[model samples]
Target chain A: MEIPDKSATAPDFAEPPVFAEPWHAELFAMTVHLHKQGLFSWLDWTAQLSEALAAAGKHHTLDGGDDYYAVWLDTLLQIMIAQGVTDDSSVQAMQEQWRNAYVRTPHGKPVRLADDGAD
Target chain B: MPHEHDDHNAHSLLPSEPALRVRALETILTRKGLVSAETLDEIIDVYAHKIGPHIGAKIVARAWIDSDFKQALLTNAESILGEMKLAGRQGEHVQVVENTANIHNMVVCTLCSCYPWPLLGIPPSWYKSDAYRKRAVREPRAVLAEFGITPSQTQSVRVWDSTAEMRYLVLPMMPVAAAGCDEATLARWVTRDCMVGTGIPKAPQI
Candidate 1:
């Protein structure tokens, strides 16, 4: 991703789509909710989200949802670790599961762990 | 019955390339410690259960009952909304477009999916699709038609494009059946599509 340096404004990225993917809402709400809980202040969230935006742009991976949320999820996880709220391994494991689920699911099914037998 | 084991699916453990890349960055960030799964789940649950388009319904109902509120909504929506304790969040600027006999409004973020999140909890998945973004602006009538709304040809079609600074909500024409209804009951008639200008509110059956 294009991690913009300090003093660099974000590129003219498209405004977030209004009706976006479920994952985007999940990431967006989680970010908002965490900020509300004082996990990180708005300033911290902005900087992190901005960095994610730039990075996603750099990698040609920013989409309306997937990459966008993925970047956001990474930023939140990173900030939490920086603040000692959480660690890398925990989020890493979770992300791995989500990623795996997303990859293996059919084109139109919910992402889930392969070992998860229940619907 | 044979023991049901998740048989070999070699690719099952692997994520999409983009997903892997994100996981890798996450790994790098917290190489030392971990964030709790509970935190993430708590946040997700709140959004899943608590938020939706109901807030927008309240605003629409208020506008219906009070002309002054409607005037305030059209002229100074941000402050008025703030007075109702809804200041724009995430750098949002909001405006409301009223549907009239001669004009029908629709909203699209041609550049992206900018929306009034404070009013409507989250934009639906369909709103963010490239198809809706590209086609809604160019062929709003056709798009609306697909949604089963065919505004008369004489009614002007106004398409509002959202930006990071500004977003829109459509104030649909209140139906005659709702004339004597209470605000909460009337609010029920205001669907999300009404605010997007693709649908009209239907009054309750007496």
Candidate 2:
């Protein structure tokens, strides 16, 4: 909704932004976008995220599959963006890209980001 | 047909769906070395800006203005946020750290993205970087420099990596000029870098 100054650092890059509200889908959407854009190879990302979780497991002395996945998603986006593979914009751009890349038919339409029902 | 959709939704919780298309791009970029700083900025401008910090600013503003709320935030973050009806769906147990000159804080999920979603809307682009994760804990000063933050001789920085059971978010100290400022105005000062403990909140130019 708000476009920060481009010169200003992205919250994910420089500072974490605090929100008065909760937006879980938004977070999921970001990850899905990066995943769509090919910032990190899925296999590499999955392995690293799993490793991050395994490391956390040692620290907390607990099994953290979901937490590991969440961290993986977070880290995947972070590193990929850092590496310049694809960013928040590219992730967001996936919608338009997919729309343009895929053709729609009368029976079914190509997947749009909002259509993560398939996800 | 509808049942098939439901079945997909059921399996969504499992990590089976490979997040196909994005991964392909990552492969290409990896081959091309396209994940540079400038390209990342452009990428976030498109996608991350869609949701992350725009939401985070409001949370920073509220924390600056409210005292009892701040104390409540410091302890039992999840329930307090739930009382405000802002607890995120997956934000299980969240914690807030106050960043001060004497002691600064940086958060990482050396393992994954275990962030305090109730307060900070989303983690930043760099927080997820392998270089950042590997270097931050071992070589924080160097990483902080990339974000333009260099601590003074007296300051000590502490980095915490969030795990599922415990997630962390930094409560950057409110600026003096920010006193009596409205939430929207105050939010402007809460830069994305500051929340991650990469930089200090900049003072207004005279």
Candidate 3:
């Protein structure tokens, strides 16, 4: 199957476009999905994110880059942990697994949990 | 999990840490049946294709032609937008501020990038930039000038700070050259910057 070139069709704007990276869009979609699943209310999500931003603001400027979404990812984890949806250890372990999987997968291939099992 | 790497070149292909982290989170959540990949794809598709400034422009065009809609939009935008099936998620609470002869309105989120996503899609990078967030509230006129909009000295600039609680969309004044034009034509003149108060619709050439 052939994939269309998204960059070729994207509109040119004076400034950088939102969702500069695919993961940014994925993170946003996951938050919305989790919110829709009754994991947390939108208000709660915003409050937690607001608090996270406030805390991060003290240490560095929020430039809406990886750092901004890093705070978002942290806020999401914090909420999930606080709500007993998932524990810190499990997430950490899973992250380690993914890191290993990513390191084993070849270039331009999708990283999968099964790839981690090859070891 | 082992830390052994079979492919040395794979290290160079590793995505950013946050990228890997998000992928892990999604994988865990999906395995636990908390989130469906299809739903995630649907949401991303909607934002990337279906939603954008074009929707907001259509609404603004209707307001430009209809006095009653303009009044209803300003008075109670949430319900009005809900009626149009445009109310959701980031647009739960909305306020439409009008630009007139005497007053000019601009929006920024001092806390974070809180915007009316259903109407405007994802915000522009500049909107979420540190410089814009800090300067927009401090000196809106100068910021507007940077966007090539120099609101006359007679006009008072009102900078609204958006929060997750409420989002603001600027209703730019219709250009004189657009008089008697249809709603579609008027909408063509309304750009994302116009709705964000950084730019105004230029007069359409006949």
Q: After superposition, how far is residue B147 of candidate 1 from its true place, in Å?
A: 1.0
- Models ranked on lDDT: 3, 1, 2
Ranked by TM-score, the better of candidates 1 and 3 is 3
DockQ, candidate no. 2: 0.08
The segments of candidate 1 whose C-alpha lies over 4 angstroms from its true place after superposition are A1-26, A30-119, B1-39, B204-206
Q: List TM-scores of chain B, every candidate.
A: 0.83, 0.68, 0.90
- For model 1, what is the alpha-carbon lDDT of residue A116? 54
Query: Per-residue lDDT tens digits of candidate 2, residues A34-111?
Result: 555665454455456657656665555432233433454556566767876567676556534444333331224333
Choose 1 or 3, whichever is better by lDDT: 3
CA lDDT, candidate 1, residue B11: 40
lDDT of each: 0.67, 0.56, 0.82
**Which candidate number maximizes DockQ?**
3
lDDT of 1 at B12: 39
lDDT (10s digit) by residue, model 1, range B39-138: 6456555445444566787789889999999999999899998888776766567999999999999998764456777777666656655567668989
lDDT string for model 2 (B12-130, tens) is 22112223334333433534554333454454444434545545556666778988877888877678767867665443566777877788788777755556554555555456545
